[model samples]
Target: MKILIAIDGSKASGLAVKSAIGLAKAMGKPPTLVLMHADVPLMRRVAAELGTEGTRRYHQENHDHAMKSARTALKRAKLAFSEKLVVDDAGPAIAKAAKGGKFDLVVMGSHGRTALASALLGSVAAKVLSQSTVPVLIVR
Candidate 1:
């Protein structure tokens, strides 16, 4: 099975990573895991202020920090996986990756927002669920 795990450096996302590992193990076969981080695009003004090198450094640092916990979990589980960092909206980015990669499942964390709150703020998980073609396993 091929799995895509979307992480955002939150406690919930950490749990999602753990859940994906458990699911893969339960399947009784080594699955291909893709660990993905969707980075928010920097504002044009901020990028100009930071310059090319500074902007690159900033994005790299943020990606490293965001992937740290997920990487550690995968290492501890002895799971081999590829890492991807994309600068785009999280939901659409995840959906595009899942579809383009032909992954069987996409695992991600949910903030467990109330219906009203989610409707008001537009939840990433909800958006992903709506847009994804493959099955999405949401870990709260």
Candidate 2:
């Protein structure tokens, strides 16, 4: 079995990681786990202001920051896993990775925005659930 978990450096995502651990244990084998962090693109003006190298650094920093806690937790659990940092919107990126990587499942944490807020700002979880070919497990 293969699982891809989205990490956004939040407590909710940490819960998702814990759920992933339990799920893997229940499967009776150590499944392949992949930690993915999606980098929201910077505004055009900001990117231009940062220049090429600076922009690269910005994304790299963001990736590191987002992956930090998730990585620590996985390591603490004695789980072997790989990680990826993709520069794209979270919803599309996760759905694409789940399909492209041939993962059996995609797990992510949701802030559980109110209906109005979700409608206005759009829900990443909803988008992923709609677009993903694989099943998605959302932890609140």
Candidate 3:
């Protein structure tokens, strides 16, 4: 099975990575894994202030920080995976990557928002569940 794991350097996402590792081990096959981080676009003013090289460095640092936990977990588990960084909204970016990669499943962490809060602030997991063509496993 091919799996796409969305990570944001959070405790919840660490759990999700662990779960995916377990799932892969239980499957008795080394499933293909992709660790993805979505980078939010910088404001025009901020971009201008930072310049091209500085902006690139900033985004690279963010990606490294976001993927740190996931990378460590995967390495500790002796799992081989690829990484992708997208500059877009999290939910849509995840969904698009899942679809484009033709992955069997997408695993991600949830913030466990209440219905009202989800409705008001929008949940990434909820959006991925609604928008992704592939199945999504949300680890809380």
lDDT of 2: 0.92
How well does each candidate superpose onto the true structure, as a TM-score?
Answer: 0.95, 0.95, 0.96
Model 2 misplaced stretches (Cα beyond 4 Å) = none
Worst 10 residues of 2 by lDDT: 20-29
lDDT of 3: 0.93
Q: Is candidate 1 or candidate 2 better by lDDT?
A: 1
Q: How high is the CA lDDT of each candidate model?
A: 0.93, 0.92, 0.93
Candidate 1 TM-score, true structure as reference = 0.95
Residue lDDT tens for model 2, 69-136: 88888898888899999989999999999999999999899998999999999988899999999999
RMSD of 1: 1.0
RMSD, candidate 2, Å: 1.0
- Please write out the lDDT profile of model 1 over residues 1-140, one tens digit for every residue: 99999989999899999999898788878999999999888999999999999988888888899999999999999999999988889999999999999999999999899999999999999989999999999999
Model 1, which residues run further than 4 Å from truth?
none
